[model samples]
Target: MRRILIVGAGQAGLQLALGLQAQDYDVTVMSNRTADEIRGGRVMSTQCMFDQALQHERDTQINFWESQAPRVQGLGVSVAAPDGSRAIDWLGHLDHYAQSVDQRLKMAGWLETFAQRGGQLVVHGAAVSDLDFFARTYDLVLVAAGKGELVSMFARDAERSPYDAPQRALAVAYVHGLGPRPEHPDTEAVRCNLVPGVGELFVIPCLTTSGRCDTLFWEGVPGGPLDVFRDIKDPAEHLATTLELMEKFLPWEYARATKVELTDAGGTLAGRYAPTVRKPVGRLPGGGAVLGVADVVVANDPITGQGSNSASKCAAAYLAAILEHGDRPFDEAWMQATFDRYWETARHVTTWTNAMLAPPPEHVVNMLGAAGELQPVADRFANGFNNPADFEEWFYDPAKTEAYLASVTG
Candidate 1:
């Protein structure tokens, strides 16, 4: 049994750990917080797992919340006009459903699962110095902690990373009593409202520690009017401010959010990070080599909600890479090749997501508008959430978009 140490207990780390445990490899995970501490903590992210990613969890038998979580069946996008009315509005159907389960519920539950099943769980914050020591005992070490001092060990891959600073000021609140979209009275969907200059608003239905709820999130363009959540520490004030913004910029959404209340005192999250891609291997001061996983290596802005999805896929891809190596030394060459396998898919996600951060080019804008008139186009756009690679075929190029539109319209 080869011993492995994972320095983070997030989706990628935990999933990979559990998968290795089942295969009878000696596995250990280090988490900064215990399961109970995590359960009692604040919301972490605005994450929604689409079909492809969810299937990976199901394959590993780690999708314990499947029956309890709401199945978000589609995505509804509305571009706000100058007066806050919808300039173009349509709901695109996903071939299969997606879901959002709060990390407070998921990471905590997964932590417990990893421990309950005889995998070693270390409750401590791991730094590079810690890994320098642990590397002597474990045959392999992977860092999945996306944020922390540990991330600095993995240098940024300048060629792959474009932004040096954050593009959006993010704010999120989980609440109960958010009414359904009246237009799609029976649909369980994610709503994305795009405000050209200010930012974007997304309403995600999710299952949390409390039960099913909605996550009202904002991605404000940096230094823009909506970039205003940094100073408000009070959860009530945070929510109130969220509602006020909705009323002003997305009136229709505000109409339904009028009576909502926080799911708990810790149901709000506010912060920002630049989308970055880092080298796969982290080198310790003591000459120990460590591998970086998921957001630690390839952090997308979450503008397209790919954080959790990408993490799950990364774990799966790495699991396959490890299982195939069959006792090969986990060296720098192995780590880079492992990441290269995951990047085959992650590259598409990074490309599509990065493009969304900029104002859409005329061709992209035309395609979005066309979705309103073409059901097939809307369906393709919505389904792209599951596989962003599809966008490359028709979404990025002017000539491709023009040809695809002509083929569809006729």
Candidate 2:
């Protein structure tokens, strides 16, 4: 059996390890925290996985929370106006429902499941030196956790990475009691409110350790008024600040947020990371080569909410690559080729996500405006979240946007 060591226990690493285990390969996973620690830790993200991404989880049989989580049927976009009204508002229905499960609940459960299946679990913080030693014993070592010094092993791909600083100061609070949009009270949806230069707010329905709840997230333009979570030491204070900003910039959303409370003491989170694409292979000091996985190689900002989905796809793609390689040595050439294959799909996501960090071109703005008047345009935009690659078909180009709008409106 081919021996593989997967480092990091986030969505990608754990998913890949579990997949390999199911294949009956000799697989071992290293996690920095025990399942208990992860279960007790703060929420990791507002991971709302659309159809394709969710399908990857189902294919692997790890989607344990699907039955309990809220089914987000569509996504609504409202451009906030200076007069406290919506300048442009529309809700685009997704063909398939998306769902979010707190990482605390999912990761911990996955960690235990991996062990229950007889897969070796190493509960230790892995360093470069540790990998160098492990490489001598394991036929392949893959880095899935992007945090810590392990990230330094992958060189930044400057050509593909467009930003050096975080585009947004991100903050999130998992809460209970968030009411649905008044107009769509009977429907569950992901609400995205854009405050022009200020930034964007996302209200996502999710399932947490405490059961059904919502994630109120803010992606504040750096140094903007909403980028004020730096000193928040209390979760209640964080929720209050989130509410204050909502009241000022998104009164309609605040109308429903007034009575919401944090889901738990560790339910609030604040941080930011620049979007970057790194070389696929991580080199160790001992000349051992390890492959970087998912966010370790292509870490995009969560503004587009593609992080978890990208991770799931990355794991699935890599699993296929590994299986196909058979007994062949997992060399640098193979590692680069595997990543290149995944990038065929990921590049589209990268392009669309990076474009969003900048001011939308007039043509792009026009398309969004047109979406409000046309259901086809709205549905296309909504489903693009499931397949961001579709945006290149009509979203980015002025000519194509014009042609598409004309086709739908006429």
Using lDDT as the measure, the top candidate is: 1
Clashing pairs in 2: none
Q: Give the alpha carbon lDDT tens digit for every residue of 249-340 in model 2.
A: 99999999888999999999999898999999988888989999999999998888899999999999999999999999999999999999
Q: How many backbone clashes does candidate 2 have?
A: 0
Global lDDT of each candidate: 0.94, 0.93
Q: Candidate 1, residues 72-124: lDDT per residue as tens digits?
A: 99998999999878999999999999999999899999999889999999999
Instruction: Give all TM-scores, in the order shown.
Output: 0.99, 0.99
For model 2 the TM-score comes to 0.99
Clashing pairs in model 1, backbone N/Cα/C closer than 3 A: none
Quality of model 1 by C-alpha lDDT:
0.94
